[model samples]
Target chain A: MNEEENRPVRWNLDDNGVAELIMCDRERNNLFTDSFIDAFLGALSEIEKERPICLLISGLPDVFSGGADKETLLDLCDGKIVVKDLEISERLVAAPFPIVSAMQGHAVGGGLVIGLCSDVMVLARESRYGAVFMNLGFTPGMGTTELLPMAFGPFIASEMMLGGRMFRGSELAERGVPVNAIVPKADVYRRARRIALQIADKPVDSVYLLKYTLSSEKRKRLIDARRNEDLMHRITFPMPETRRRISEQYNE
Target chain B: MTKEEVIEVIKRNIVENLDDVEADSIDATKSMKEYGANSLDMIEVVSTSMRELNIKIPRSELAELGNIDELADKFMEYINKG
Candidate 1:
């Protein structure tokens, strides 16, 4: 396969001081495989070095992310890896520059939570987004318990986390999801680029400081939520039923 | 369309969305889980079925459905109303 086909995640810094991290693991539907995680974190590290004023994160045309890989979940269930091993969400929350999540496709479970960590978000009306950990027979993880409520409000977050139902972006807009914009799928990336460019136009220091100030409280809450979620995962992830679900219910 | 037709639509969508599952083998009395349909697969099945049937049901309302039969019944209710 060519490099584009081989690489799952890639990043580049534009002249306008806006960096883009694009996930394009088409064969895997952007699932968080081990290589994908490594590439994602490595790209983030490289992007940070560029000192971009803003960042835009996106995925393939139809899927922002498919969330945790089934094998990863099975490893967690088998006591081979811990929940903290997945650090994408933590890195997103800790990034120095503001992030615009250009989720022009489906974002499920941890995928949606990571997008929720962004300073701003643009979603596609046709794409589905959900906190679907409960449907996989496990408690929410990757700081989702805190981030979902922060992004979608308390009651809607409760319904999503508890029900584990996938909601279309239009439905989420109707239900008052506080994203920056819910536009046509084709417009999602353009809208996000506009927001990112707007942020990039500001003085770099001012934008950085603003992002830091805005996300500080959220970062603190996420730390606590991660701790609590890890505890819950310890209790819930090892269930025989959860293992069964991971083995049988996972489709891709 | 009748309730049986609704069930057929649902079954057709399920076969299209899920892997290795055939409509002939699908048991209406069993949950989609029994047919190895994951949560995402179920969502696709329900969404496509609703699109084909020209019905819209809130996902929350469909969360507690026990089996394909119950799903068909719920779809029938909306179909009758429309």
Candidate 2:
């Protein structure tokens, strides 16, 4: 089937002047795959064209995204697909309008990077957030290195990346990540939409310019992290240890 | 530097930066992907090439890159312009 008939991301311009891109890969916990990328790109194109005052990203209430799959990662190692083609981190960072993340579920793996890249984040107090890459015997990818330090402090970021720790949404807020709201799981999207509507009520140019002007620091960190993570991933993915880890996971 | 010499530098740098890469797989006309180069590897390769070759490539010019062939040509053009 063509992309439109089966796209995972659902897009709509709400009456409140906000553009909403909700992820609905119910079968996979919204795990990122090629189809997910295609759906996201298609949604991004629509958001760019419409230039809605602001954007909101939401997924299932239990899981923001399951993150990268091992099979696709093996594809990356095999030179079948470039991480650049995924473009989730860069696209979220460079989006012309303010992008808000309605994170109620766990933002694990690649989801963590995307969460930090967003302009504003309102996470559910009970939801989990983490960079669980190290536990899988590989370095994190998709710019988590740069972004974690920028969002969480360097100390926490390092522990999260190196030690594979998971934190509650309230913990991130306590760490000074400026969570716009820390509500219950069911309230995550409603609060995010309220915030998006507030942003949407502002002048479009004002919002875009504000995002561009202030996002430089975060963008720089993302670049540094994206490069370093990808480089380390290159070194680690081909190692026997990581390969064994992958095999172990498959047999499970 | 001659085009052949430049190509040689590119090949050496790729193999050095990426342990998985094989020297024999380096083709003058082929892109870095032929040697299993990813975006991250390519970034390091391009940076090393510029540093070793003493060339300054414009970011816009870098965006238009097609492959290693175009990259070498771009480096030569930058060198000639300098």
Q: Best by lDDT, which number? A: 1
lDDT of 1 at A244: 74
Off by over 4 Å in 1: A83-85, B1-5, B8-82
- Please tell me how candidate 2 rates in CAPRI terms: incorrect
> Candidates' lDDT values, in order?
0.86, 0.76
lDDT of 1 by residue, A1-252 (tens): 877668999889999999999999988888888888888899999999999999999998889998898889998898786543358888899899999999998899878976988999999876788888987789998888888888889999999899787777777888778879999889999999999999999999999899999999879889989899988888888899999767755642
Query: Which candidate number would show the highest TM-score if scored against the true structure?
Result: 1
TM-scores vs. true structure, each candidate: 0.79, 0.70
Q: lDDT by residue for model 2 over A1-252, one digit each (tens)?
A: 665536578888977668888887776667787778788878888889998889899887678886887778666655465664338888888888889899878788888777788888888765677788876678887778777777777888898889675666655666676556777778988888888888888899998899898888877877787778777877877777776665554442
DockQ of each model against the real complex?
A: 0.09, 0.01
After the best TM-score superposition of candidate 2, give how far the Cα of residue A59 lies from its true spot, in angstroms: 0.2
- CA error at residue A211 for candidate 2, angstroms: 1.3
